[model samples]
Target: MTSTSGARSHTSPWELYDGLTALVPRGVTVTTCVVSRWALVETDAGGAGLSSVPDDGRDDPHGPQDVVGQDLADVAALVRSWDRRLAAIGLASINAWCNTQERLEAHAGDVIDWDASAFERSGELVQGRRVAVVGRFRHLDQLASRCDLTVLERRPQGRDLPDAAAEFVLPEVDHAFITSMTLANKTLPRLLELSGGARTTLVGPSTPLAPEAFAGRVDEISGSLVYDAPWCRRALMQGQGMASMRGALTLFNLRVPA
Candidate 1:
């Protein structure tokens, strides 16, 4: 008989939020928060974090769009308490902000500067397996040449499959590369559910490095850390993307312990 256990194998954003919030100690105050091309948060403790700013401001279900004036600690605490569908992007940024501080204080030793490319690490794992990529990446051309690959984009472009294909194609693949923006869009849980037996990985600049948040559901978490918050903020405020801003970021990866 197939053994049925406790909650199904998936990482709920709320679960991640709970795990993340537990690490945040009291008395830490938010020093600054800016939402431009990128959402940025800096705590009084000199820790900073960045994320893709949420769009659809008009459709945000959480009260108003004026989160600019709220308390950082209060906003961070409320992030875990809200329904995932409400003001999702904003919540994602807030979570990233809180997680940055928490990781700086607690997991400082675990955060290391990565010299290798994330695509190389991903390519090594999918050697002979079919691959399903959830978001478009510039390095995809390298991977496509080696294996059968399907790329699903929210806005289908060129050869990319539409988002609907995720449910149909993900289960059949041997490995998957899912974007960390899924958390901002409130699709991470569902994507993880669709991942099935694939060695699934969450990849992007927006991903949080909170291992406890990912736990068993994710095989790897590849994301960025703010190396120079002031520079990043200035570029973001000037409408430049992450790539346009140099020396402001560092890439990092966390493999889930087996």
Candidate 2:
């Protein structure tokens, strides 16, 4: 499901965090939490947030101090933490908070064209175009065969370019699918600036999904919604990630019209 009907807000990438922070309501507290390979948070209001935990050699998150039962605002503030895991947790908190408030009914697929997977419906738009994908999505061969593609990963894999390549590559691409990890890593604003005139989509489970937070930087927002917060929290506790989310998630996209 998707909608361009999202109410708009800040236009500068610098104000993105401010816009996201505002989506989180006051007084709601996280009632259940898991910090593993993926960070998951379920709020008292029944909203759930899930995010990829950055594997930066950090042995632990919060060192058993406990994240659950904390006021969400305190957790959300950690989105700016230099510690990557804390940032991931903070982002999940923000997403969880927004899930409780955003009107998904207005953004249903009947009102806007959103695929179960962004790459699912990409052949027509990217075939023959210069495509740049950030974070190396799992089902990437689909995109690889359809376009002149370049992938940027912070941890370079076979044929993948490190993010340093963005300065030199993004400016020349026709389209860019950037991972929302850039938000956790504090590089999203810069990535947006480097994408130049390329059409940019902010994608992945970590996406905050607040259209106004990305109004000027992204052309589309593709993120996941967890149907059963408890199930997802259990999966996270078991150290599972998106591969195990078959029945729990519904991926969707929101187009920001030019």
Per-residue lDDT for 1-258 in model 2, tens only? 122222233356547777788778788888987888788888888788887777663444446247888999888877777677888888889888764324455555422344367777777789899999988788889888999999999898999999799999987888889988788778887777777578777888887767756666678888877777777877777878778765787676777544
Assess every candidate by TM-score: 0.80, 0.88
Clash pairs (backbone) in predicted model 2: none
Which one wins on lDDT?
Answer: 2
* lDDT values, one for every candidate: 0.64, 0.76
RMSD list, candidates in order = 4.5, 4.0
**Candidate 1: where are CA atoms >4 Å away?**
1-13, 54-71, 77-113
State the RMSD for candidate 1. Answer: 4.5
lDDT of 1 by residue, 1-258 (tens): 111111236434577666655655556566666666566767666667666644433333544344444455565654433333233434434444544544544655554336344676666566667988998777788888777899998787998999888989977887778887677666777877777567777787777777666666777777776767889778877888867754766677666533
Give the candidate number with the greatest TM-score: 2
